[model samples]
Target chain A: MCVLAEEGYTGTADVKAFLAEHHGLALSDVDGHLYHHLNEEAIRHLFRVSSSLDSMVLGEPQILGQVKDAYGYASEFKSIGAVLDKFFSKAFSVAKRVRTETKVASSAVSISYAGVELARKIFGDLKDKTVMLIGAGEMCELAARHLLNAGVKGIMVTNRTYERAVKLAEEFDGTAIRFEEMVSHLKTADIVISSTGSPHFILKRDDVEEVIRIRRNRPMFFVDMAVPRDIDPDINDIDNVYVYDIDDLNNVIETNLEERQKEAGRAEEIVVTEVAAFRRWLDAQQVTPTIVSLRRKFDEIREAEVAKAMSMLGTDDPKTRKVVEALASSILNKVLHAPVTALKNDGNGRDPMELVAVVRELFDLTDGGKDCE
Target chain B: MQTLLLKSTTATYLVGALLYLYFIVTLKERGARLGRMFLLIGVVMHLFGFGMRFAEAGHTPITNLFESLSFFALVIVGAFLATELRYNLRVLGAFVAPLAFLFSLLSAFQKSELQSLNPALNSSWLPVHVIVLFIAYAFFAVQFAAGIMYLMQERQLKGKHLGAIFKRLPSLDVLDDINYRCLTIGFPLLTIGIITGSVWAQDAWGTYWSWDPKETASLATWLVYAALLHGRLTVGWRGRKAAIVAIVGFLLVVFTFLGINLLPAGKHTYASIAR
Candidate 1:
């Protein structure tokens, strides 16, 4: 029954540590019972749904799924209790609600998809476009998937690691080209998604310029979704080469964000409604312990009084003692009825805490005090 | 009544800006809370002001540059408030509030000449074009803020000097993601704005590709951002270099919005602040 609270931790690692340190709750502790009552409020607030913690990209929908997965893992381990279980279930519901109700989730599209969309804008139909994916990274895979889904005619994947490139190409039904042949393919590529993890530019300005010259200004869309960017910054200078680096994609991101923001407001309203509901449930929970204590106290008093009355009547007549015992039990039941009803009804109060306090005070239910004695 | 509300709201925002500055310089958590309170107050007041302006103007408070600029400032503030509420990015207030305050002050200083809508600007396309462009500009402004944070965080990481500022700022990855996200969202809006503006221009001026100074600067700004996005997505431009580019792109947006308007030779000369 130890309760501990701490200022919110910012980092994921820090949160994990905090949970472990304070609750003596390791990820391993998440048993079914614990999971059933998982500390979802803390999780939600820390993870950023309630506080919008998961929204670093501001309403991007991916993080909520990640959080759910984290909770699922915790639940699997049986570390969470009744509190955590209820909390997390509600959190999942909230996340789902937000996703459904909020424009927030809808407006902010992923950068990877933005790349493909941008390409589509330039080239009306991607069905005939040849997309060259340079550097077999995560972004490349994402962009490639989008392009393929858009019915791009062909895909050429090139990576410094030939084996990785080959694996990626195989999955996407794309051809694996050697990294050296990137510029060669660039001339033919209607759209290029460059996502290499290179420290330097993989495609130099001169190289892209040369490719553009060979292509004769037919409009090549380049999507650079890489860090330290795979394509040279200078390639934007080339005519008809519509190049969009990460920063340039802001315009698209903003429009999507605005749409998402609109959705988020709806989601937030849902969260607020859900939070109030959960609070009521919590309030009702408080009455349970009180009701249990009050019932135990009344039963003990009835038993003690009946024993004394039975002793007084038994010597004269066993039948009389039986009648007296029956009467006493009936009276006890009647006396206990109204208080129990009150306790139950008290939960419906606007401030249930006050009612709980009043009930506790009225019963003199001290933590260690025996009311019957 | 509306005019008074708007004036008071602008005053509140100015106060909020000061409080935010204090929060940044003092680096006190309480200061952050105080700053937020001020901002919230300012926003509430600004909303009142806007309502008043709408009531008095009998139109969308976006007809003249003065009203439009005021609306623009309000939109930026609204955008910031939304961002702050969602991300809990109070630190951004230090940078964003000042800009918002400056815009507000500029709006306040400008003559409130309630000119009749020009016949050319009378079309329905004007509001749509302007709204989209202004919103796009707001997003870019945020990108600029994120870029500044990115560079600072990068320097801190590289220098191994994780100070209070470093801790307060988001991680490098987060900053980069924010920058990317902002760009991705803003770019399309800008494109739409440009397209709509061109269409509107064609309706008014009988030509779409006039290459006016404002048009050219906007195109240039769009190109710069386009390049930045391409660099980040295709070329893998990120961290400090990407941040610098983002900052540079925002400057271009500023130039397109403010600087180009000041220049004498442009069809947008009427929209200029100078005259």
Candidate 2:
């Protein structure tokens, strides 16, 4: 089983050798083009995965949480080593930035939510408005739930079958009105949200006019969520009647999705910036351990020789001994300056790791102090 | 002391109005709170001013142009606050508070001298007629504001822009509800106010009906509101049409209060509002 843990595996040569020798795994080399396509080209794969950019559904939210859970599980298993520790944290931060700094998850991505958004625009506050459902079906029921979430004051359901209306209304904690009495009840409903699988139109212009008359021409919003709209399109001509069909609602959804995609672009930018920052920090740090050990080894040799010479001169001339010690330390510092400068600066922003490797080999420095946590 | 109180009240309302208009332009909801606070403070000061004047005069303190118009402004704020409490719509104040502020500003310029009530106008019904009528006017002002908001929201919805104001203002249903509520309450009060006015006129002038310009205008205003009420309930005549009616009715009320004096046949001039 070649369990290539792309997330937690840090790709150490020793670990790969051990896995191949002990687990009888073959080290299949990825061609240069494939490696670029997989790793270099999409180094922010963690970010994209967390933000659901890799998922079939564009900008889905659950993947981010799922990615977090997976990282948490890996952390619990003591599996993500030091290298992946930094990578996962950066990924989490990118995901959070994408969530907040952009509108990726703010707008509605579903038809039901689209209806609710339209309702919000027409009637600024839904907390006091009544929503009437002309018929109960899967879509109608879903829309009813969305309206409920929007804080509509009450819900009224009417259907060809009174029993079905009663059932739907009961499930939603609403009242069931007779389909025939929909006109009379229209006087009370500020929003008429309907989706019925009927062959013909259930409501007509004259019917709406009758309701408008009863309502004294107060504003009435009708959302036809069905293909064959339950309400007449011409009812919009009535003084306070506003009707929207399923296509209009779909258009709203499409617009909202486009907005989310735009926001996703911003999210990707943030991820790219963060990934580059993480990489720079990683590059700047790979030689930190060797440099620290080298400095330690030089200081120990200088201190040992100074202490031995001070004992030979004795405590009889403390000032003279101190001057000798200062001279000795100054010479040591002068001698180490050139090498330290070379190690610190590798021209044109090149990685200092190469210099550290050469210096470590020359000074016999060991990996004694890893700089990154 | 009365003059000082009226001036302070006007200042307070001015502040309130500025805050509300600021909210309208900026879409900052906190402006509504500050505006409401200023209006409430102004209302308190105005009532105190009226109280002190009433104590000094041994009457309702509505016997002069300054006193009457100032009282008119006060009642408008009071009615608006009542609706605010009922509906709890903070945005309502943003639309309606400025009118109260403007009215009070005009009242500040009104002649503030105290005057005794004329014997002809000293019937027990004096307070009933004037108070109810001014209150009716205030409700109509609120109705007018709601109507304007409804129209603006309608335009935004039709244009499909749904701008900041469209979102900040109450929905068309809500605005229409405000209009309906104000009308239902204002209509009956207006009817009663008119009836009381005629009774006072009958007692003072020995006639129940007159062709006085103010009287005719008041009747016209009443007829307009009555028709609106009738149309709303009987025929479902609401929304844009209802909003238009409220706006028209408010114009008539303004004319009944300010324009009736221009007529040569006017027995009741705007000054007579204080009578």
Per-candidate Cα lDDT values, in order, are: 0.70, 0.76
Which candidate comes out best when scored by TM-score? Answer: 2
- In every candidate, how many clashes are there? 83, 7
lDDT (10s digit) by residue, model 1, range A1-373: 1121322213444545556668777655633223211343644363245325346766655666666676677779865545445566777777766655544554326777777655643455678889888876676687788778889999888888899889988998889999887777777898888877789888788887777666644567778878777787667666456677776665566666665666555665666666666655544446677788777887788789877877765575768777877888788789878877777776454344455556767877654323111
True contacts kept of each: 0.00, 0.53
- Categorize the docking of model 1: incorrect
What DockQ would you assign to candidate 2?
Answer: 0.32
Interface RMSD per candidate? 16.0, 2.8
Q: Could you estimate the TM-score for every candidate?
A: 0.44, 0.63
DockQ of each: 0.02, 0.32
lDDT, candidate 2, A1-373, per-residue tens: 1222432233445455666567465654322112222343444777677776666656788887887777788889876555456667777777788877777776667778767876776676789989899887777788889899989999999998999999988998999999888878888998888887888888888888877766655577888888777788888777667777877667666766777787778888887877677665455435555557777887898889878887887765878777877987799789887877766665125335545545666887644323322
> Relative to the unseen true structure, what is the C-alpha lDDT of residue B76 in candidate 2, on a scale of 0 to 100?
85
Q: Name the runs in model 1 displaced over 4 angstroms.
A: A1-373, B25-28
How well is each residue in B123-204 modelled by candidate 2, as lDDT tens digits?
Answer: 7887888899999999999999889988988776654444456546666767888989999899999999989988888888
